[model samples]
Target chain A: MSDPTVVPWPRPVSAARPESVLTVDDILVRFQTRDASVTAVDRMTFDVRHGEFISVIGPSGCGKSTLFNVIGGLITPTSGLVTVAGEPIRGPHPAIGMVFQEESTFPWRTVLDNVAFPLEVRGVSRRVRLEKARDVVAMVGLTGFEGHYPSELSGGMRQRVSIARTLASEPKILLMDEPFAALDEQTRLLLGDKVLQIQQTLKQTTLLITHSITEAVQLSDRVVVMSYRPGRLKRIVDIDLPHPRTSEIMTSDAFGHYVAEIWGDLRDEASRGMAEAEASRGART
Target chain B: MSISRADHAPALVGAATLLGLFALLELAIRAGLVDRYVVPPPSDVVASFARIVTEEDIPHRFAQTALEGLGAAVLIALVGIPAGLLLYRHMVLRVAVQSWVAALAAAPLVLAYPLFLVIFGRSAMTIVMMGFISGVAPVTLKTLEGLSATRRVLIDVGRSLKLTPAQQFRLVLLPAAVPTIFVGLRLGLVFALINIVGLEFLINFGGLGQLINELAERYDLAGTYAAIAFVVLVSVLFFLALERTERWLRPGR
Candidate 1:
């Protein structure tokens, strides 16, 4: 069942408010195997406004990544539509850029080259692309390391390079799939801050898939919580916090309330997910 | 400084071990603990190196083996890499032929020298062609392995950027696969060199293998060892060149 309640931005009424940049409208995704077909997502509907930062959180088995693939145009939904700037995505669209959780930086290329890869693929001239890449690199706080390779950088820095690469394309919507899941908590928090800063500066419309309630509360304007397998929107929690958010805001009572609210919604789905996982393992054994 | 020392440790130990083995063989032969005829004393082999260089016209023979091995390497690169790419590109082709190609790598290809001789007529062409077929298997198989081994995330990154198939290959897939492809290349070269030398010895035509055959027939055990040593040198040079090329292609690895 699709939740028809599309959350309105709680900002003060202003003429300068931006329009919707991305829409995930009534989406469903099903994967077929040798013996059975699995429904991963069902009637998933959400809209990311022009400059909103949103996080979608769910249990481990929830179809967050499945939904992300549909939005990124890497996979088509079994039914329904994903659009960027009102254009339906047939395949990977230039208006939608994605940063994966896994290490996606090419080890062979220098930071500058890695950042410039999207522009290069788009056939932008070398000088112009490098110029644009430099700007993104600096925005990601990876300056003075342009000549360095991914192998030389720490894991956090490499993720930054991945982000810079996507930003270099200047997509209308940025999709990040648990981009900090691989990092330690400390590094994740710091990188989360960097992402918040970058989003604030560029006003980039972003959707993040995360399992971390603290992360969702720390970075998102609104957090979409999803149910277990055959993932559906469980609730959309409004994170009514001030801008210029950082780890410091994580100490605020409002932040804790948001985290607790989302966690309260997630705990049951997580237990169901764990029980299903245990049952599957029992069957295999 | 410490890292450089650590890096050179294996090579230094290897050189020392080689020299120690030669010394041990020399001592064993002198003390009559081993037969000196079949395995000539290291000193005798060393002394004959000069004579082979001057009398047997070693330089020309060395050059011939090098050229044959080089030709095989070029052929392997040209045919094997594309074959790998084709296999990767088409699932049906890969499923149908990959196992057979893998079997070819393990097959006793050198025993089929008669067929190559019949086809190419006992010339360097025969040797080159035999080496090519023998070596090409590994290159093709490894190329497929390398391409297949590329991380899924990297391919997704390319797709997310809307890269074309060709762009994905060149910019993402190929570069990511280079180290593995080079492993395939190196293994192919070894196979190619072994076949080239063995075929030259069999047909009694050209290269260090021919000199090796002649020296053995003449019962010039020391000179035979000297020529075999030159064959080893040729193999070393080919590998060294391949290493240089790999480093050039994917630097700072």
Candidate 2:
């Protein structure tokens, strides 16, 4: 099969440094309900090195989002510490930026304005921000369409705009919550290539929350698998794929091996997740 | 971006249907198929427009009604929009006052013109106040609804950016609520105009409504119909201006 996800442009070579940029130490998140207190994340400990791409894969109810939120400082952990470059995160940290799963591009803003939003909020000068916005917009291959509104862009393009917006602030880490979960398989693969290229270009440290086996193996330096809720660390599988990765590598034997290994780790947890989901739904009715 | 012929179809059809109805009324009256006293010939009504302008001083009356309607609209936007924001800001205030605002929208507030006249004392203030009360509800309710209806994800996006509370409201919340707020504004204007004209007719104070009452009392059917036409004209003009403003604010919509 031909690979459309591979862009024609040359990718700059950059290696991940051994120094840890983000550390989540024994993080726990618990939600209290009228009936019972639910533990969402339990003792999830991990460290992301500078310029590493990490994908956390799990079953649907595996609390990947809970962990993602905790790391982003959106949810205060019931206990444990989250630190960025040794500094603790009490709230939304300046060192981290996030992309949401849902459609998040401001409808009122054009492509340039949407990308410039973070800078604008930081009180960056209009001329400087727009110039920086133009550069990021070009980086995302959305040049010549800066004036187009979110409503005018395709789903993939809007997600690209979201990515550009986050990158504008030059955060130390990027946290994405299934940013391509809403797109189809083909678009997902294409966007994965785009994201891979951008990450390589900027040498950005990224943590992706996703359920896709192919995506986990295709983009990650390491895949962290989680068990179903009460989510916990299952295993961390290092992807042995080559650098400057593309969807073309998806057919390789190493990539297939990683997919199967991660799938093995997830299958039992996925079944458990489904059973609990059914039980809770039945109780609701 | 290009306007096609099909895009204009509904408007063209509407204009044609109205002209056809007017022509039918004109023919029926002239052919003696209908009572000329009750339903004046369309031709006579059209001719009476010039007479009313010359004799009845229609310009001043039109201006009075326009001014009252403008006053009500200004109050609706200024007081009504801020009231909505305040209500949205305070959950306690919103829960306490939301249902009453909804009830106010449904109430026949024009009937309370006498109460307004007593308070503001038999002047333009009375008419404007009546209109303002009648019109304010939709603006308040719609504003509340619009703010409440903003997607949670958008707010999360703003929060993730670490935006201050004021910046979040001004940047994310207000702009997202705008299209729906404009819906309320348009509806509120319609209600305000109706109450303004209705009160004018009731109090025999000024504007097309008072002119309609005077022409009817004089037993001039053509003049009454002519005055009614001007009232319709005012409503149409108001709607057009509002739509223009809305389009300018949200061009993507």
Q: Write the per-residue lDDT of candidate 2 for residues B202-253, one digit (tens) a residue.
A: 9999898899999999999999999999888888888888888877766665
lDDT of each residue in A1-285, candidate 2, tens digit only: 744433233334448447899998998889999999999999999999888899998999779998988888888999999999999999899899999899899988999999999999999999999999999999989998899998999999999999999999898999999999999999999999989999988889999999999998999989899999888998898887777788999989988888888999998999988888999899999
Q: Largest TM-score belongs to which candidate?
A: 1
Cα distance off (Å), candidate 1, residue A64:
0.4
TM-score of 2: 0.94
The TM-scores, chain A only, for the candidates as listed are 0.94, 0.93
The CAPRI-style docking tier of model 2 reads medium
Separately for all candidates shown, the number of backbone clashes (residues 3 or more apart, or on different chains) is: 0, 0
Looking only at chain B, model 2 earns a TM-score of 0.93
Tens digit of lDDT per residue, candidate 1, span B15-105?
A: 9999999999999999999998889999999999999999999999999999999999999999999999999999999999999999999
| Reference-based lDDT, each prediction | 0.91, 0.90
